[model samples]
Target: MKIAFVGKGGSGKTTLAALFARHMVETGRPVLAIDADINQHLAAALGAPAEEATLPPLGEHLPAIKEYLRGDNPRIASAAEMVKTTPPGRGSRLLRVVEENPVYAACVRPVGGVRLAATGAFTEADLGVACYHSKVGAVELLLNHLVDGPGEYVVVDMTAGADSFASGLFTRFDRTVLVCEPTLRSVGVYRQYASYARDYGVALSVVGNKVEDAADVDFLREHVGADLLTWVSRSAYVRRAERGTVGPLAELEPANRAVLARLAEAVDTTAQDWDRFTRYAHEFHRRNAAAWANERAGTDLTRQIDPDFVLGPSALSAPVAG
Candidate 1:
C-alpha cells in the first residue's frame, strides 16, 4: 500500500506520518517512509539523530537513479532522456516494496527500525532557479516503477497544502490521509484538496488532529462530512515526542495509538488498481512531455510508455523483454 499524508503547514501531517510508519513497523509490516515535504523534518520525527538522519538526497542523484532504473530498456537511449514522468518500459528495472537495490542502498536509511528516504532539501542555490517539484520528482519516478504487495507500505509525508496538485505525484498514492485541524483555514485547505482530487479519482480520508472537545469534532463533521475517518485528541505523548524527548510507540495515548491502527486498516482494505495506476502514469507523462519535458529532452517522451506494461506484483513475474 502507498499512502500520503498532506495538510496545511503546521498541521501535524509529518508527525502523523511518522507515527503511522512506526506503528506499521512495530506490527512487523515492511514499511518505507519517505519525506517528500520540502521542510524535510520526517527523519527527526522518526527518531533519527540529526547527524545520521541526513541521508543522501534523492534529487541530488537523479542522473544515477534514472540510469539504474532504465536498465537495458531500448526505448530509453540515455539517462538524460528520462524525465520524472517517464514510465517504465520492457527491460526497465522494477522494484519490490522493500528491496536490496542500488536505489535503496544509496537513498534509504534506517530510523528506529523503519526504512526512510528523503527528497533532498531545497537549498540556497535552488532559491530562484528551481521548483521543489523537481526534487519530489525523484520520488515520483521511483513510485512509477515500484511494485508493492499486501502488508508492505510506502508512507510519504507530502509537501503541505494543495501544492502537490502542481504535479502528477498527487495521484500516485492509493490513499491520501489529509490531516485537518479544527480550524477554518485548515478546512479550507481540505476543501481545495478535495475539489482537485475529486476530479481525478483520488481516494481521500480526512484525519482530524488536535481535537480538544466535542465542538472540534462537530466542526470536522460539519465540514468534512462522511470523509472524516478518524481524529486524534491533544496528546501529551506526541507533545513530548515533538519536543525531542522521543518515546516508544507504547508511550503514546491509547486513543491516538488506536487512530494509527485505524489508519493502517483503512489503507490495508483499499485495493490497488494497477490499471488506473498505469493509465495515470501515461496520462501525466504525456502532459509533462507536451508541457515542457519534450522540449527539455529534445524528444517525444510519450514513447517512453510501455503500452503492454502494467504495474503490480504480476509485472515482476511477466517477461519484461519485448
Candidate 2:
C-alpha cells in the first residue's frame, strides 16, 4: 500500500507518518518511508542518529537516478526530459519496492527497520526562481515508476498545507491520512484537501491529533464526520520523542495504538483499483497542466500523458474543479 500523510504545518503529520511506518515495521511488514516534506525531518522523528538521518535527497541526484532507472533504455536521455505524469513505456524502467533494485539502492537508505528516502531541502540558493515543485516533480517521477506488491508498504510525509494540490502527487497514494488538529484552521485545511481529493476517488481519513478531551473528539466528529477515522490524545511521550529526549517510537500509548491499529486494518483491507487509478492520474495531470504548469513553464506538460495509456474512470466525472 502507498500511504501519504498530509495536513497543515505543525499539525504533527510528520510524526504520525513516522510512527505509522514504525508500527508497520514492528508488525513484520517491509516499509519504505519517504520524507516528501520540504522541511524533511522525518528521519529524526523516526529515531535515526543525526548523521544517519541526513541521506542525500533523491531529488538532488536526478541525473544519477535517470541513469540507474533508465538502464538499457536509450529513449530517456536525461532526467530533465522527464515529466510528472510519465508512465513506464516499453523501454522504461520499473522499480520494485523492498527489493534489491538499482534505483532503490541509489535512492534509499536503512534507518532502523524502515528504509528512508528524502526529497532534499530547498536551500537559500534556490531563492525566488527555483520552485519547490521541482523536488516534488522528482518524487512524482520516482513513484510513477515504482511497483509495490501486497506485503510491501510505502509511506510518504507530504509537504504541508494545500500546496500538494499544485501537482498530481495526491492522486498517487492508495490512501491519504490527514492529521488535523482541533483548531478551525486545521479543519479548514481538511476541507480544502477533501474538496480536491474527493474528485479523484482517493480514500481519505482524518486522524485527529492533540485531542484533549471528549469535547475535542466530539468537535472533530461533528466537523469532519465520517471522514474522521481516529484520534490520538496529546502525549508527553510524543513531545519527548519530538525533542529527541526519548528513544525510537517503538511503543505507542494504548489509545494511540488502538487508533493506529484500526488505521492499519483499513489500509490492509482496502482494494486498490489500478484501472481507476491510472485514469485519475492522467486526468489530474491534464487539469494541472492546463490550469498552471503550461503558463508557469511555458510548455504544455499535459501532452506527456501518452495517448496509448490505459483510460479508466475519469476523476473529473464529478463537478469539482481541483
Candidate 3:
C-alpha cells in the first residue's frame, strides 16, 4: 500500500511518517520511505546515519534516470520534462519495486530495515524562478512507474500545505493521513486538503497530533468528526528522538502504539479505486499541461499518456506504453 502524510508545518507529519515506516519495518515488512517534503528531514527522523542522510536527491540525477528508464527512446526529451503521468513507450523502461536495477540502486538507500529516498532540498540558486514542482515531478515519476506488491509499503512525507495539489501526486496514494493538531490553522489545512482531494475519491483520515487532554480531543472530534481515525499525545520521547538523543523508537507509549497499529490496519485493508485514480490522474495531467506546461515549455506533454494503456489493478504489473 502507498500512504502519504500531509499537514501544516510543525504539526508533526514527518514524525508520524517516520514512526509508521519504522513500525512497518519492525513487523518484517518491506518498506520504502520517500521524503517528498521540501524540508527533507525524514532521514534524520528515521534514525539514518549521517552518511545515509546526505544521499543526494533523486531529482538531481535526471540524465541517469532518463538513460535507465527511457534508454534510447527518442520520444522523451529528457527526464526533467517527464511528469507524473508520462507513460513509457516502445523503447522506454519499466520498474518493479525493490528490483535490482541501476535506477533503484542509485535512488534508494538502506537505513536500518526500511529503504529511503528523498527529493533533494532547494538551494539558494532556486531563489526566484525555479519551481519546486520539478523536484515534485521526480517523485511523481517514481511513484507512477514503480510497481509495488501486496505486502510492500511506500510511505511518502509530502510537502506541507496545498502545494502538492498542483500535480496529481495526491492521487497516487492509497490513503492519505492528515496529521492535524488541535488548532484552527491545522484544521483549516485539513479543510483545504479535503476540498481538493474529495473530487478524486481519495481516502483521507485525520490523525490528531499533540493532543493534551479530553478537551483537545473534543475539539478535533467537533472539527473533523467522522474523519478522525486516531490521536497521538505530545511526547518527551519524540522530542528526544528528534534531538538525536534516542535510538530506535521502540518504546512508544502504549496508546500511541495502538493508534499506529490501527492506522496500519486501516491502510492495509482499505480497497483501492484504480478506476477513479486513473481518471483523476488523466484529468489533472490535462489541466496542468494545458494551463502551464504547454504554454511554458512549448510542447503538449499531455499527448504522452497513451489512450490504449488500461490502468487497472493489473496495469501496475503490465509494461507501460507511451
Q: lDDT winner among the candidates? A: 1
Write candidate 3's Cα lDDT for 155-175 as tens digits. 999999888887888888989
RMSD of each: 1.3, 6.0, 2.6
Listed in order, each prediction's TM-score against the native is 0.98, 0.88, 0.91
C-alpha lDDT score of every prediction, in listed order: 0.92, 0.78, 0.80
Q: Which pairs clash (backbone N, Cα, C closer than 3 Å) in model 2?
A: none
Model 2 residue 123 CA deviation (Å) reads 1.8
- Using TM-score, give the best candidate's number: 1
| Candidate 1: pairs in clash | none
Q: Which structure is stronger by lDDT: 1 or 2?
A: 1
Q: Which ten contiguous residues of candidate 3 have the minimum total lDDT?
A: 313-322
Winner by TM-score between candidate 3 and candidate 2: 3
| Residue-wise C-alpha lDDT for candidate 2, range 177-212, written one tens digit per residue | 999999999999999999988877889999999999
